[model samples]
Target: MYISKKEIEVRYAETDQMGIVYHANYLIWMELGRTALIQEMGFSYADMEKDGIISPVIDIAVSYKKSLHYGETAIVYTWVEAYNGFKTTYGYEIKTPDNETALTGTSSHICVKKENFKPIQFRKYYPEWHKAYEEAKK
Candidate 1:
């Protein structure tokens, strides 16, 4: 499996009065991780957009294992969990600099037409992109 990692600094604004990183911040971290993964896969999601393909998250699930505090560096680990004709799933892990896992999550997304916003199957539209995913699937 291919994995991508990115580091991010936890800002004070990310924490609540209790000094714990807000739950929502993990979602942002996941985005960062996903972006890195896409780049590592040799594909610019931005390019996909320019090509008239837009991928939008249909669902996400996150579980917190420990709390994070401001000023700490976070390592976001990401992977392309699964890819199908109609949907793709990305997995993520957010951890501290010391390798302590703080969160685990996954997000599901679908590619659609940019103009009409209609769903598009990978095999039917971008066969090469789908092939790369299939190669990685092995």
Candidate 2:
């Protein structure tokens, strides 16, 4: 599998009253990880939006194992977990500098026509991107 790693510095704004990172912030980190993976594959989500296609998450699952605090750095490791022409699942792992997993998750998304929100196959609009997912799945 091809994994893309993004290092994020935990900011104070991302934390809660107790100073630990909030749960929802991890979702945002996951988005960054996903975008990093797409960019690494040479595809731009902005261009896809300009093409009138939008990919939205249909489902997500996350597990938090350790608490991260502000001033700490977390590395997000992302990869293609599975892909069909219609839907793609991306897996992620957020780890500390020591490589200990702090969180693990997967997000599944489907391409849709922005105008109608009707589901579309990624292969039809972005064959190279689709093929990259296929290659990464192996």
Candidate 3:
């Protein structure tokens, strides 16, 4: 599998009252990881949007294992978990500097025509992108 890594410096704003990173912030980190993965694969989500297609999240699953505090750094690992012609699922793992997993999750998305929100096969529009996902998901 092709894994992309992104390092994030936890900020105070991402913490809760108890000074630990809030649970919801991990979802943001997952997005960062996903963007990094796509960029690593030589594709830009912005370009997809310019083409009048949008990939919206259809499902999400996340699990928290450890708490991090402000000033700590976390590394997010992301990869394509599954991809079909109509949908793609990205898997993610957020880890501490020591490589201990703090959270794990998957986000599934489907491409649609931005004008009418009709579902579309990603391969029909972006064959290279679809092939990349197929190759990476192995």
Candidate 4:
């Protein structure tokens, strides 16, 4: 499978009172990873948006395995977990500098018209993009 990697530097402001990275930060990291994955796959979310479509997350789930601290670099690995004509699920793994898994998750999204929020047939709307995802998910 085609997996994309992105490195994020944890900031002090991103930590909780306990000095550990806040849980919600994982969602942001997933988005960064997803953006990288899309770029790696030769697609751009911006282009899709400019074409009057926007992909919105429908579901998300994350599991915390280890605590991430400030001043540390986190590497996020992203890949296509599932894809169909209607929706796509992106998988993610955030690891610490020491190579320990800090979090794992998946976010599901569906493409819709930006104007009316109506769902689109992704395969028909972007055949090449859909085929690329299909090949990557293999």
Q: For residues 116-135, what per-residue lDDT tens digits would candidate 1 score against the true structure?
A: 99998867777776777776
- Model 4 residue runs over 4 Å out of place are none
Candidate 1: give the clashing pairs.
Answer: none
lDDT of 4 at 97: 97
Worst 10 residues of 4 by lDDT: 129-138
**Model 2 regions lying over 4 Å from their true place:** none
Give the C-alpha lDDT of model 2. 0.94
Question: Model 2, range 1-138, lDDT digits (tens) per residue?
Answer: 899999999999999999999999999999999999999999999999999999999999999999999999999999999999889999999998788899999999999999999998788778898888889983
Which one wins by lDDT: 1 or 3?
Answer: 3
Q: Write the per-residue lDDT of candidate 4 for residues 1-138, one digit (tens) a residue.
A: 999999999999999988899999989999999999999999999999999999999999999999999999999999999997789999999999999999999999999999999999999999999999999983
> Would you give me the overall lDDT of model 3?
0.94
How do the predictions measure up, each by TM-score? 0.91, 0.97, 0.97, 0.97
Each model's total of backbone clashes: 0, 0, 0, 0
Report the Cα lDDT for residue 40, model 3. Answer: 97
Error of 1 at 134 (Å): 1.7
